[model samples]
Each structure stands twice: as C-alpha cells, then as structure tokens.
Target chain A: MNVTVKTFAQLREITQEGCFTLTLPESAVTMGDVITLLKSRSDKWSQALGASAGSENGSVLMARNQQLCDIQTHVQPGDELAFFPPVTGG
Target chain B: MFALIGDADFDQQWLYNRLRQEASQKAKGNVGAIVTFTGLVRDNNADGNILGIELEHYPGMTEQALTNLVQEAITRFSLTSAGAVHRVGRLYNDEQIVWVGTAAPHRAAAFEGANFLMDMLKQSVPLWKKEFTRDNSRWVEVKASDDKAALAWLREK
Candidate 1:
C-alpha cells in the first residue's frame, strides 16, 4: 500500500520534508503502526515523534484526512496523514 | 458561520452588508433584532508593544470548528442568522480582524448569539497568533483571563 505523509513546524523542519509519497507494507494497517514504522526509518523521525520531550508530547499533532485523530485510527492506502505542532490560536 | 483565512485584508463594509443581507433574507419576517461585534488589531496584547501579528490556522479543521461553533450559537440562542469572519496574515494596528453577527427575534438573543460566536471561536478554532514587537516576536498563549471570560458566559445561560 502507498500513503502520503505530512509533517509541520518542528517536525517538518526536522524531517526536512513537508510531505511525500511513500510505500508502506501491507502489514502496517493503522496510524499507530505507521508512526512506529516511520520511527524505524530514521533517528530524526524517532526524536520528532517521541512520546514526550521536556513534558510535552514532542509538540506534534497528527491528522488523518484533515480531522484530528489518535494514532490507532485505521489507515487506508491513499490516506493523507499530516503531522504538525499543537495549534496556538484565538 | 463564515470564515476567510488567507493573506488578504477583508473589506469591513462588505462583511457588514453581507451579514445584514443574510439576516434580512433569513429573517423572512421572523427576525426582529440583529447584533454584530467586530474586533480590531490593537498595539498591545496583555504584554506591551505588539506592533502587529500573524494568524495561522489548520485549513480544513479551522472551517469545521467555526461551523460547529456557529451551529451551537444558532441552537443556543434560537438565532435566525449568524455569521463570523476572521482575517488572516499580517494585520496592522487598528485594522479589523474579526466580526461576529447574529439575528434573532429578540435583542438579548441576538446580543448573546454574537458574543457566543466570538467566544467560541477564540477557544475552539485551531488558529494561532504570533505577536511581533519592535525587538522580537512570540507566539500568543491562551490567557487564563480569556478562559474566564468564556466561562462567565456559560454561567449566564
């Protein structure tokens, strides 16, 4: 299966890529699995996706198809997953 | 609820006329009062020396949030019409940044409805502001005072 992944703010800056097309194995089926999979890809991703840093959740927020979702949400082949920092708006 | 997020400066009269037109059309003899609130960019935040600010938002999520907020206002206040617009990008001092307008059968509802829209948008909308001063820039944090203001409204209901 294939998916397009996106990251924003520090994640994007760390990854050096905003979004990209990628191929995923059939065994990887959910968002959590994808995060783990991405972590396996590089140390940079691992740090950026880490559970917490200095008490915050690594300052990354994930969205599947533009809706905020947890890591366990099921992933489809053509899904667009975006990762960004927590919103700071009024 | 209507929201415009971009690099453009919104037309103030255009929005006002648009909201009035929407209220008039939706009224169809039902609405008896319309109230609107507009917030402008000021030179100061809680901290001094805010030269200007930039607004950033999640494109799709921001719209969804605003829609949900407006729907809530309509239901809560029995509103016939409601609209809100928040400008994005670089905004100068004293420039209009946001407007929330509501129409209802009575003055209290209209007033409360408009207030509700602004209050809800401030808390729920996935938008962030960065304030720039003469020497530095910093992200604006959600103040406890804002939360208190929003909470006060709930007590009224």
Candidate 2:
C-alpha cells in the first residue's frame, strides 16, 4: 500500500519536507508503523517522531484522512496521514 | 450550520448579526439570547513581548473539526444556531484570532454552548499558533491548563 505523509509546524521544520510519498508493505499498516519506518532512516527522524518535548502525551498528533485518530488506526492505499504537535490555536 | 476557517479578516459584528438574522427566521421569538467569544492576539506571552502571531491549519480537517464542535454544542445545549470562524496567517498584536458563538432560547444555553465551542477549538481543532517575539519565533505548545479546560467541559453533565 501507499500513503502520502504530511508534516506541519515544527515537524515540518525537523523533517525539512512538507509532503512525501511512501510505499509500505501490508504488514506495515498503521501510523506508528510509518513513524518507525522513518526512524530507521536517520537519527533526526528518530527524535522528531519519537516523542516531542513538552508533549505530555509523548507523541505528536495523528490524523488519518483528515480526522484525528490513534496511531493504531488502519492505513490503506491512497490515505492521507498527517503529523504535528498538539494544536494550540484558539 | 457549519464553521469557517481561512486567512481572511472578519467583522465580528457582521458575523453576530448574520447568525441572529438566520436564526430569527426559524427561532422567531424563541431565540432570546446570543453569546460570543473572540480570541485576540496579545502583545505578550511567556515568550515575552510578541510582535505578532502566525496561525496554520490543516484545511479540510479544521473545517470538519469546527463543524463537528458546533454540532455537538447545538445538540448538547439546545442552541438554535451556532457558528465559529478562525483566522490564519500573520496576525499582529490586538488582531482577532477567533470567533465562536451560539444562539439559544435562553442565556444559559447560549453561554454554555459558546464556552463549549471555545474549549473544543483549543483542544481538538487542527489549528496551530506560532508566537513571534522581536528576537525569536516559536510554535505555541498546548498548555496543561488548556487540557484542563477542555476536560472540565467533558466532565460537565
């Protein structure tokens, strides 16, 4: 399956990319699995996605198909998954 | 019915009057109250004297989140109408950041529904704020107090 990943705010700054295309095996089928795969690519990827500082929840927000979802949310082909820190706007 | 999210400036009075006008058609004499809350960009924060703030949002998700919040408020508070608007892009000190409101048959429901929308905006809306001081700019992180505020609403019966 393929997924388009998007990062926002500080996550974008860290990744230095706004969007990316990734091809993953069926076994790697969740938001967390995607993050783990990225972490395997570089040290920066590890910390950026590992657990952000000041995040009491210890992870960035995950959105699957534009709705907030848990990392365990299923990922399918052509899904849009986003990652970013906790929202602070009013 | 639903909310708006964009980078354009808004007229708060126009918004309220519009909501009232729309509700008057159906609510007639029943809508006796309207309540609104506006968030403004301030000059200071823990980050010191701020020059301005920049807001970012995930376009589709933000509108969906706000619309759902308004729907939840209407259902829970028996509101006759509800609306929310959030501004994105660079906003200077004292500029409007957001507006969320509700109209109801009574002041109590209007007040509660307005508060619910504001709280939900802080907790669930996919909008991000970045504070810009003269020297540095940083992404605003969600405060522990904000989570507590949202939790209070959830705990209410």
Candidate 3:
C-alpha cells in the first residue's frame, strides 16, 4: 500500500521533507509501522519521530486522514498521514 | 464561521458587525450581547525579544478543526452565532493573529462561549507557531496551562 506522509513545523525542518509517498507492505498496517520504517531511514528521521531525548512523551504528533490519531490507529492504502508538533495556536 | 487566513489582516469590526447581524436575524433580534477576542503577537517570549514569528498548519485539518470548535461552542453555550479567523505564515510583532466573536441573548453566554472557543482552539487546532529572536528561532511549546483550561470545561459537565 502507498501512504502519503506529511511533516510540518519543526518536524518538517528536521526531516527537511514536507510531503512524500511511502510504500508499505501489507504487514505494515498501522501508523506505528510507518514510523518504524521512517525512523530507520536516517538519523534525522529517528530524531524527529522517536521519543523525546530524555522524556517519555513521543516527540511527534500523528494524524490519519487529517484527524488526530495515535500510533495504534490503522492505516489503509491511499491514506494521508501527518506528523507535527503539539499545537500552539490560539 | 471559521477561516484560516494567511499573510493578511482581518477587519475586527467587520466580523463583529457580521456576527451581530447574523445573530439578531437568526434569533429574532433577541441577541443581547456580543463578545469578541483578538490575539496579538507579543514582541517577546522567555528567550528574549521576538523579532517575528511564522505559523504553519495542516491545510484541510485546520479548517475542519476550527469549524468544529465554533460549532461546539454554539451548541454548548447556546450561542446564536460564533466565528473565528486565524492568520498563518510570516507575521510581525504586535499584529493581530487571531479573532473570535460570539453572540447570544445574554452576556454570560456570549462571554463563556468566546472563552470556550479560545480554550479549545489552543488545544485542538493543528496550527504550530515558531518564534524568531535575534539569535535563534524555536517552535513554541504547548503549555500545560492550556490543557488544564480545556479540561476544566469537560469537568464542568
């Protein structure tokens, strides 16, 4: 399956890629799987998507099909996934 | 009504008047109060004096999230009307960054409606802010106080 991944704000700055298409195997069916694949691509990817340096909280936020979701959420073919920082707008 | 504007300033008076007009028409002129809030970019943060800031948002999700917020406020507070406009992209200090207006038959509802809108907006909106100072720039961290404020509403129920 092909999923479109989007990174925003500091995540975008760190990864240096705004949007891209990722090819995932049928076994990689969850957002966690997607993160696992991306984190292995490079050190920048790992730092951007991995848990915070010294904190338990995940450094990045995730969304599936534009709605906020967690790593356990399922992802299907053609889904749009987004990764960003915690919201800070008023 | 809700909008995600970019690189442009919105007319506060225009939105206020529009809300009043719509609320009066919808509620048969029973609207007794209209409340509005405008957020401006401060010139400084804890790091130092902020030269400016840039805002980014997930395009489709941003609109949906803001609209949901306004609708939730209307239902929760019995507001006749509610609207919000947020600016994105590059913005200078002291500039208007956001505007929210609410109208109701009483002052209390209007006041609380606008407050609820702002509180919820801070927590759920997908927009992110990056502040630029003289020597460095950093993404604004989410405030625990904001989460507390939003949760306070849930506890009220």
Best by lDDT: 3
What DockQ does each prediction reach against the true complex?
A: 0.25, 0.51, 0.50
**C-alpha root-mean-square deviation, candidate 3:** 3.2
Ranking by lDDT: 3, 2, 1
Off by over 4 Å in 2: A51-56, B144-157
TM-score of 3: 0.91
lDDT of 1 by residue, B35-87 (tens): 87878888997767688887777677677767777878988899887877777
Ranking by DockQ: 2, 3, 1
lDDT of 3 by residue, B71-124 (tens): 889998999999999999989999999999998999999999989888788887
Q: What is the DockQ of the complex in model 3?
A: 0.50
lDDT of 1 at B83: 79
TM-score of each: 0.77, 0.91, 0.91
Candidate 3, which segments miss by more than 4 Å at Cα? A52-56, B144-157
Q: Give the clashing residue pairs of candidate 1, or none.
A: A88-B128, A89-B127, A89-B128
Model 3, A58: alpha-carbon shift in Å? 2.8
- Report every candidate's CA lDDT: 0.72, 0.80, 0.82
Tell me the lDDT of model 1 at A70.
57
Instruction: Name the regions of candidate 1 deviating beyond 4 angstroms.
Output: A9-16, A40-44, A52-59, B143-157
Clashing pairs in 3: none
Candidate maximizing DockQ: 2
Error of 3 at B85 (Å): 0.5
